[model samples]
Target: MRHIIAVLLENEAGALSRVAGLFSARGYNIESLTVAPTDDPTLSRMTLVTTGNDEIVEQIKKQLNKLIDTVKLLDLSEGPHIEREMMMVKVRAEREDREELKRLTDIFRAKIIDVTDTSYVIELTGASRKLDAFIDTLPGGAIIEVVRSGPTGIARGEKGLVL
Candidate 1:
């Protein structure tokens, strides 16, 4: 099963490296990871996506909790949560295809952040499925590049992870 694990850790050097090293040492795959400083400058929040069975997930949680930098940890997948990923796709938008590209952008509610005579850069944020759908609908051989921020999520309701 896929699990989205939220981790609060000390915003100090080597914190990220230690977490990544732990995963590498255990031979576990991380599908996506997003980390940034939270409201507190002394801490960072990491949203990690991984797939494994219940037993493996449990092991992952236990190992993570053992990290010295870990301040709090939560498996957001255990509760109601929202996930979003941001992507920037550059497409070959020639004169004849500009109209169609604009229409598609409007349909997806994506923004044309940059444009040139032969290309357009679009910015979009939404669920992973939605982003994939947008990419699937693009004209064949029109995509120049795509950059994704991966999935970051938060739990619903008033409760949250804090140090």
Candidate 2:
């Protein structure tokens, strides 16, 4: 039972620390977390991924509500939502392999954001699985580095999770 929780909280120093502390103190685990200022400068939106059973997830929600900074919360996983992750991979791309790599990137609809004589940096965004598939397609020895922005999710339809 993986859950994607969206939280709206005051955008202030120590706010993120407190939320993370709560999870640690409770022995809960957060797989991924992404937070940034929202349109309202006074608040921030955080999307966190975690896995737990129904009871544990209920407890996590309750504990989150008890935080003073929490303005609103929603378990996006419980409703219709979309999740995406972005990744950048640097891979060997010598002349002999350049065309093949480019073709594969085109198939995945990824872009070569940077390139050198022997290496290429690709940018990709999609479901986590899709990104993993792309990585698997590349030769292991060709991968120089990889960076990912963990999955972020939002609910569908006109409704939004707000105070």
* Per-prediction TM-score to the true structure, in the order listed: 0.97, 0.95
Residue range 1-163, candidate 1, lDDT tens digits: 9999999999999999999999999988899888999999999999899999999999999999999999999999999999899999999999889999999999999999999999999999998899999999999999999999989998999997886
Question: What are the per-residue Cα lDDT tens digits for candidate 2 across 1-163?
Answer: 9999999999999899998999999999899888999999999999999999999999999999899999999999999999999999999999778999999999999999999999999999997889999999997688999999988888999998776
> Candidate 2 has what TM-score?
0.95
Off by over 4 Å in 2: none
The list of candidate 1 runs beyond 4 A from truth reads none
lDDT of 1: 0.94
Clashing residue pairs found in predicted model 2: none
User: Candidate 1, 8: how far from true, in Å?
Assistant: 0.4
